[model samples]
Target: MKALAALALFLLALHPLSSSAQVAPAYHARAEQLLPLLGKDGGEKDFFSDLFLTAVPVNQWRALTADLRRQYGEPQSLGSVRQNGPTAGQVEVRYRRATVGFTLVIAPEAPNRVIGLQIVGAKQADDSLIKVIDDFEALPGQTAFAIARLTDGGPQWIATRAPDRQMATGSSFKLYVLAELARAVEAGERRWSDVIPLSHKSFSGRLLAYPDRAPMTLHSLATTMIAESDNSAADTLLLALGRENVDATLSRAGHAEADAALPLLTTAEAFALKMPANASLRQSYARASIAQRRAMLRDHAARLDAKAVDIGTVAETPASIDSAEWFASPKDEVALLDWLRRHGGEALPIMAVNPGIAPADAARWKYLGYKGGSEPGVMAMNFLAQAKDGSWYAVTGSWNNPAARLDEPRFVALMTRALNLLAETSR
Candidate 1:
């Protein structure tokens, strides 16, 4: 989803900027007012809204703010500020207890407002896949990287830094729901035009935020789920298609360990699984009888509100990352993309709406489909592209670090390099 992880951005809000370059006065004043509140929570009346406030709701604001306090301790000061774009400047933030540094983006247009944020890393972004991954793996945390191409039959191994292993795939798992829905439509059991009332609601999607209770077509829901990684849309589709059915479909599409996502987690269920209380509950459920698990999950699901979720708990600890979340291998990822290319293929087109690859690179292909997922310690990107000769191929990779936040820009830079190489070589 394009939506920022609330805790990631919230933590950036607390940093003190330190820079060798000149900084705008407007940026300083805005940082002073918002930084203190972001450092430790409590002061709410001081928020100023221009673009960000209008885009994110107040409830999300509070949930994220509270989550950061538990993770980062408290903010100390703004360290340095450097202007990047006419409308963007990066600021460094210092936290009281944590050693990690943050890069805060201040909108040049609204110099008084924060626009983007990221965790800085020792290894800088590089175009070379080898160097990039070398830096990534050499960094203090764990990371797995892989790439594959879709053959006429299935994925062909290209390059990999790790063995064929399943890693946590954030919203990329929604592909399972989309695949099942498309299959049902092709079988005449359902229609793409079938209109269903928005059956669920949650954050990480624009559809849930729609003003009117307009019934959207199944096609529309599927589109937004992949295009925007809409949690509500995915949950709705999961309910309609039957979670078990999607789970089976994902396996048939080549997911190695079907049970890894067993009882097929709804976003709410998955998010709750990250919470200390619910994470324990999930473990108990996993050990319980199959007959009792679904009921137990449903009973707990009834009690959850988005606010009840820590939002940061998914990346809070190694124990949590290992115990509660979705998992997929890059090999399995390419296999699914290839399946969509040949069987009930409406999905790839819907995914094409978001080109997760470079534009110059995209131009080399007849079509491209991209889906990405992320939480605190996790990030994933999977692409399905068609060469001009109508040959179908998929390029996919994932990165994880349970101990700390990811260097999002650098990771993306690394993946983009992979995509660029495929774009150039495929032609």
Candidate 2:
């Protein structure tokens, strides 16, 4: 009897210990099944390769694997795979140098393809890279803002919203239009010096109506449109180019979200629509026939709405603008800036608008240019600057405070902080 009781007690204890041990290995094996296939042929290998090449070293890859093993203990072999929704497995993998701590992912295909990967990090760190994650996981009291800043070499970013969130581009959209026109000149579709007729109807707000017979070159119109944020100049240029051509240009330049059909300007719907504040400009607009003026306004308004608005007053409700499906990812935006830098004289007049570039810095950076946009509740800026060492960066920001009003200085300060953060991170 004594032997029997002792044997039963031992069995009971053994059962619980066995169950606990079994549980861990079961979870670990499941993780192995979900681990991303890391070689060159894998779907996400290129992304990993780029990240590793940019931030880590080839020798470090083995070290990373060893460290993972040491910390986690022996990994279990994969078991009979079971499907979980579209995923075949799931796991959390750690990388020492990644901006985020561990990467949590779900593998949907056999051989464990990555269906999703979530990076874990502090709010600021997450904003610097996985901005969409930050926005989705935003806690109470956190306000989302897009940040753009110029670093010594170029531009960098941190977003508090999804990367694709399309805020109004304000006058910044003019940059795209101007680029298109410039390209047209380059392609022989239009000449920079070609005289375009201006009319009384072309004037609005601060832009005085020009005499109907006045003529200006395409180059002058583009310069005025960007440098001075001249609406009439932009409208006239758009009319000459035609909406279809402008859209085609944007598409060619890789701006898939750009819309070409928006009218030039009207009150009800326009994005960052503006004209010269000069009285003479206003008079020129006022002197035009009411119908002609309205037609001009209608066209201008359409163009503004189509482009997205990122600039203007900082104290009022931003104009109700629709979001765009197209956006420039942080990586792509940087590439575009690099392309512009490589082709210098092509963007001369527009580049000249930036007052921030000093002569000495210009020589060191080679080419640096920036555009800023502000509206009642939105603020944004984009820059492409080259470094003395030949490196370049593209920095951009689009911020909106819809629930409360923030002063311009405060807003600018916020943007400055974002820029500073980029500089600190890059170094």
Mind giving the per-residue lDDT tens digits that candidate 1 earns over 115-227? 54454411122235566567657755556666666676556666676636778878888887888887888788889889987776666778767754469899999999998
| TM-score to true structure, per model | 0.67, 0.47
Could you give candidate 2's per-residue lDDT for residues 172-206 as a string of tens digits? 55555666676677777877788978532332434
Residue 82 in candidate 2, Cα distance off native in Å = 70
- For residue 115, model 1's alpha carbon misses the true position, in angstroms, by 19
The Cα error of candidate 1 at residue 216, in Å, is 0.8
Global local distance difference test of model 1 = 0.66
Best by TM-score: 1
Give me the candidate number with maximum lDDT: 1
lDDT for 58 in candidate 2 is 40
